[model samples]
Target: MKANDLNKWLVQERARLIDNYLNLIQKCLGGTIYEDPPLQALGSDKFDPVLREYGWDWPSMAHTMIGQKRLGNIRQLVESVLGNGIEGDFIETGVWRGGACILMRAILDAYHITDRCVWLADSFEGLPPPNEEMYPADAGDNFHTFNDLRISLETVQHNFQKYGLWDQQVRVLKGWFKDTLPNAPIDKLAILRLDGDMYESTWDALNALYNKVSIGGYVIVDDYHVVQGCKLAVQTFLAEKRLSPVLQEIDGVGVYWQVANGTSSS
Candidate 1:
């Protein structure tokens, strides 16, 4: 199947899972559990205004599950924390459709953080050849071809513009993390969202940007639980550096870590 088709399928599957989970959560909380309400009600009402502002339309309930329910939870958490901070800018190392960035920009606007910027860094060329150390012996090429899956900087820029986010607060850095991260014009980051799929990409991003993450800041590894290599890289790096942070799992795939103390301002 084509990438778009695959994405559609993935979105559908994820949405189904989210619906089940939401119902389960409501049951646990003793709330009324409705079956797949309108897409607008799939998640929280707080996100509805932003979603409408961005011209986001959910053709299927599953689309809302993937886009709003699953991904929306992560966006809400980051926005709630970083949206009120005075520390640093927002950064996303691997952006696919620019959805998360758009959500973040909305949060920035809603919070009136005019001075802080959001840096978007992506190759747009797809995944680089995986280093063997990062991949399992049994892993195949199924997840390797990002060439067709990756969205270009220009495309993402257009996305930002479409969402009315193409202002001074948004910056796009185009190239591989290994080469572009050093010169990405960012001093520090309050929220660093890592979406890189492989070990090498994750490692490069962490090494280059982790030090710049402010205390009380958040580091969101998008593929942490979904991709074994990505998880390994994060664990290995934390082990080697002797650094540990509280990790919260979102959507069973993403991991969010908060720096231990709020003393440092990097």
Candidate 2:
């Protein structure tokens, strides 16, 4: 489908599909555990709009904070890259249950984009605990200990297969972002998505891969509004690099910016 047309269709269908999927999952599983007990205590009514809008208040079927609105935002970004003929592969630096990454690959398949691949980067062990000595902004973070957030590489691959989207075009960079991103053989990126929740992980990803993003491409920060540490890391990194792209909001917690340098993707 044409990009404009697909965007329109997505605007109408994305929410319906997500609601149906969530309902199906709830029916199959009976119930899901709350990863954050504090939020559970508050119940959905008491949840903040920022949290409620992005599916954070929903029962955890997956660690995906992205819901229908954010997913539509991502689809638009990825589609813009393809529609504009940007030259680079698509990459998500902090895949959890691989839902977002799967969506990336699915778009490629739908658009018949054969040259560009989707790279799934993650520790497959949830997040890494904060390194307070080096990244002080993440001092009190304990997100790494949440076992519910950790999905194994095998399970992620299985999720991909379940959608019948598993193939060579899907690559996994399985390890902590700090350990895996720097030397990963990625040639270029048309869409570099950052979901790393802490200061260290978010900082490391931009430090290692931001330079490789094509000028017309996009860099999406998933935890930007939700995680203060992630926001700080992004602001600091962009300042140090003397790069200033307008940050655009996506639903509640997610935000993204297009690389605006004069450099060409060709």
Candidate 3:
């Protein structure tokens, strides 16, 4: 087989393995494995008044499984780390429509965690030009250009407001990862979600925030499994830093890292 054919086969095999693993986990857990709800479900016209009050019109369960899984896992990890006295904020580097951030905020409210903030960072514009060294050859033009589906900072802020999260706890940073990450006022993070679809964005996020990730915190990579370039960047960075933590598979599309106490800043 040609190299390209072999690569395709490999991807298929990995996906199959991930799917099987998730099936087993779900069966064992014995709960309704929810797909993300449709975006319209949260709308005032579609949802009941009670559900609408909770910001229910978001992506369907299947659409946001990776994010939901990451959030669930991170919440468990953070609870374990801090026990009943957790004291750190949540952060997401690439928020689109603010769905995941809203979920995080909602979860915090449900758990009565009002002390911590949820930092939402994004350029609102889409992916940056691919760096040949950082991105794989097959990534193509999957991301939106700034003009294609121009999502602005104001738009995402409106999303938060729609979800009843427009409080002082939600901070929106408007700029590229490199430009905005360094200036973020975060000192220690309990959960850091990286959803940037490109290598430079992912790398910049990791560089700026990984060290600050509290021991026993969680770092979620939203595009790691679906995008080879993203997976490559994360794996390469982990290897170079000599940090080895448990790699958890989420929804066959994303991978998360549990940042244990042994995780190195080096």
Candidate 4:
């Protein structure tokens, strides 16, 4: 075979391997491995397509709960950055089980890209109580009461280890975004994904990290449409900064945009 053919074959083989690996990761994280059992029920049965697709239902043992849409979005965006030569690292503010970040690491490994890092920023104690006085948009928010949101840091680390993706390249900021993000050592970001589900969390993540995202980087608002406070915070931040990046929806509830220099919109 010619050198060009050998290179072509290698590229195809790499893509196949990465595709299969990512598919397995998606299945494992989405709990499709268990055939999507009913978490609340004592017995296993058929899965709910609608709930799983929209991430409305909880997973019994899955690593991620963002469902197929958001999970796939992370992979696509990460691959996009790598393909477009977008600079910097990847980060998620409210990584539930570290599944999304795991996928990011997996992609980097697949492409043999060693320069980028995967940053996981979460309190690991779940959402904080709504500071209603300061953030009226978060008034009456009960996300704090959701016991499932409080996955510990050790468990998250173990999750990354389980996938063989845990390494120095995966950095964990183990505190609330407001406290940790402001002083985060991350120099720049290519993908800044915000999964925090409240006004305060969203606002804090954006306030601390948005400016650090490279001009060509992406901003993924995980709960933009599903969580009103989250949406309000995003809009407020955009308005304040006069940013007008074109917004694109993912599965109705999630949305993202790529940063550009000095955009303005009313």
Q: What are the candidates' C-alpha RMSDs?
A: 14.3, 6.4, 15.3, 2.4
Error of 3 at 114 (Å): 2.7
Q: Which candidate is the best by lDDT?
A: 4
Model 3 ranges off by over 4 Å: 1-86, 133-142, 146-149, 264-266
| Model 1, span 1-266: residue lDDT tens | 99999999998996587556544432221111222222332343333433332223321221122233435554555555664563888888877666667666766665566878888788877677665654452155344553434566777677667647788888888888899997677887888888887787888898899888877777888777767778888888888877866688665667687775632211
Candidate 4, 156-250: lDDT as tens digits? 99999998999988998999888999999999999999999999999999999999988788999999998999999999999899887678988
lDDT of 1: 0.64
Pairs clashing within candidate 2: none
lDDT of each: 0.64, 0.76, 0.64, 0.88
**lDDT of each residue in 146-200, candidate 3, tens digit only:** 3433467787777667546678888878888889998788888888889887767
**Local error of candidate 1 at residue 96 (angstroms):** 1.0
Q: What are the TM-scores, per candidate, against the unseen true structure?
A: 0.69, 0.80, 0.68, 0.94
lDDT of 2: 0.76
Winner on lDDT between 1 and 2 is: 2
* Tens digit per residue, CA lDDT, model 2, 1-266: 99999999997797577546544432222122233322342255342444533556543454354654666677788878988988899899888777778778877776677898999999888888888999999999988887767789999898788777899999989888878889999999999998888999889899999888987999898889989999999999988877767788887678888887742222
Once superposed on the true structure, which residue ranges of model 1 sit more than 4 Å away at CA?
Answer: 1-66, 82-86, 133-142, 262-266
Instruction: Show model 4 residue runs off by greater than 4 Å.
Output: 41-46, 264-266
